[model samples]
Target: MAPKHQPLRTALIGLSSTAATSWASRAHLPNLLTEQGRSKFTITALQNSSVEAAQAAIKHYNLPPDTKAYGTPEDLANDPDIDVVICNTRVDKHFETVLPSIRAGKDVFIEWPIAQDLAHADELVEAARKSGSRVGIGLQRRWLPPVLKLKELIQGGSLGKVLTADVSFYNGEEDPTVLPEKLFYFTEKRYGGNPIVILGGHSLDYIFSVLGNLVPESISSQMQIRRPEVKLVDPATGKTIKTVTRDTPDILHFTARLQPSQYVVPGASFHYVFRSGQPFPGTPTANFTITLESGQIQLTAGSPPGLEFAGPGQEAKIKVWRRGSKEAEDVEWKWENVNDEIGPIAAAMQVPLYAFADGKEKGDGWVDIEDAREIARLIDGFYKKWEQDGGL
Candidate 1:
């Protein structure tokens, strides 16, 4: 581990400037360049598809010239000076990219939907266990301000006993006939970055963030491949590049019965509905609410729904309406501690860095490897159920 005063020597893999939906650029780098982020960590190296690609990224990202560049995960893992590695590659690329780092006994953080499925996610979990390297997942939703405030309110008994939770998130798909060329694999089950796991998983993660007592003991599901054919288009341009099969779920619905908890009475239920290929019509992209014994709480996204993606100027508004109140009062919430320039989304990525630098294994919104495995495993069960239902 790096010393308390010294920054953690860090390495970033898959930090591409041209990739489709570059989360590495949007949700990660900005925070690492901040004053506090710099004090806590330093970029020692990078691992890209090739050595030349890594060098290109170094220049693109404006890191120090002395930064070493590697083409392979093993080569990056072999660098003893690199204390931590952050992987932001595609979901299918995650297992191969981070396994070496875990075996090398270096700390790691990988973006959500940890792997292709439960099998790969489990393998990473076991590797981290054997190597004893602390691992964190990009389940940064719990740290978002709206989620944090909801957590405080629910857990503090501000809403009384929780009875039921209902969540609805719509991708608001911009084009019904087109998908991004690079994202073709995202709609395939084989690649494991489909709407089911990415949107469904994050929805569950955020809801559980505020309502931990509602952890599903059992789930019943219904899913359908609503869009079987889609035009693969250039993201920057609307022109069609190709047409591909969209075999993944465009509509997913689930009902869960939670295990008993102090804050929730028995028979409490959670219902989730996700729809792709359709945009919300002048309404909050997400409409979520919790029904409590004495009152209720509601959350809606000003931007697109889900804590998995956050951009500048986006907001999640929380409102509370008690039994005695005439109307719901808005709950004022904001991420005050972080620099406003970085915004809440990218700033959430730094929470684990500081935790790891301080030698702690856990902190708010930090989902460890095992926690990540469970989410993947749970979502895997959804697929099995879908299969059992003949991919309805």
Candidate 2:
């Protein structure tokens, strides 16, 4: 059921070391390069704002000599060989970089926040719509097997009624001053706003992915600045420097309502918690508890890949039990990676990508997009309520 067109052509437009390792290197490149993905797309080129950086990455990855390396976004956009552009770049530069590709009728996969706010995301959504190009946001967690299973169970009537559900996360990294400078992505808000917009956006987006559609009735959030500032030494000279004015919220808490009781996954409520600067001692861990009208399910997700950036000991576990049943059973699934599972988890989570590439999964490609946009709208709704309530 592959696409009628020949294999999709792809290129990487930002080759920073961070982008190389964080995503393109770990998941996108490796997964797409597989024999299975080879049938769908080929990684044709690498680009960067700097020629030296792009060339170094090309040589380091040992790409073919014909592989093009660019010193600017325009160069890559003009390269007719690339049909799909994967952009992993600075947050501020996302809208600018991806717009060119959209104009050229090349589909694009861009990092999250699509832009700093809703207007940009909508604009990008509209441009792609007009150009007949596909746009993918890198919120890969929605594709996880466990999540998909949960969604299916609800949709299939196995859960009967998902009465209430909760999702929570904890890891130690509360102090922004101590984090690496490159992590400004999380620390800066005006560029993309705070964790509520960034981190919470991803988690909430996935929750919407599971629930189908949501109408956020109310939202309340609080942000705290624990350290205020931090010092870092020059990597080469060992000179110390202090940074000031960390405005983003390291901690975010909120709640919203699901739309239409009819669409409610039967017995569902969501609770999410995230803690930074307080790393759990063992492996990184994420867990959720669910209560169904007939059965109960508990899920714990291990911190994989970039989560390691949050620090060690990551694992995922899902346990289920029938009401009044004597015993509980654990559902076992394969781990995607040994060194760093974030890649594998992300790969597994990309269910829609495979569905789209295969051409037979059902619905237009935007089935997931519809779910995501509704979630985005809800989150925006929550933010508006927060503004009304003096949350800022």
**Candidate number of the best TM-score:** 1
Candidate 2, residues 1-392, lDDT tens digits: the string is 34546476778866556451355565566656666667887767788778788888888877777777787778788988887787777666777888878877786777665677666667777887787666666666665556666666667665566666666665434443564444555556567744566556776666666664443444444445555565543445645555655655555565544553553653245666665554465644465676777887776656622232322334456677887889988877444442332355345434445555545433333233334455457556655655565645
Question: How high is the lDDT of residue 149 in model 1?
Answer: 83
Provide the overall lDDT of each model, using Cα atoms, as 2-decimal numbers: 0.80, 0.61
lDDT, model 2, position 325 = 82
Please report the candidate that would top lDDT against the real structure: 1
lDDT at 218 for candidate 2? Answer: 41
- How many steric clashes between backbone atoms does each model show? 1, 28
lDDT of 1 by residue, 8-64 (tens): 889999897667778898778887788887887898898999999999999998899
Q: What lDDT does candidate 2 reach at residue 33?
A: 60
Q: For model 2, what is the C-alpha lDDT against the true structure?
A: 0.61
lDDT of 2 at 283: 42
Q: Give the lowest summed-lDDT range of ten residues in model 2.
A: 304-313
All candidates' TM-scores?
A: 0.94, 0.81
Kindly provide the TM-score of model 2 when superposed on the true structure, using C-alpha atoms. Answer: 0.81
Count of clashing pairs, candidate 1: 1
Q: Quote model 1's TM-score.
A: 0.94
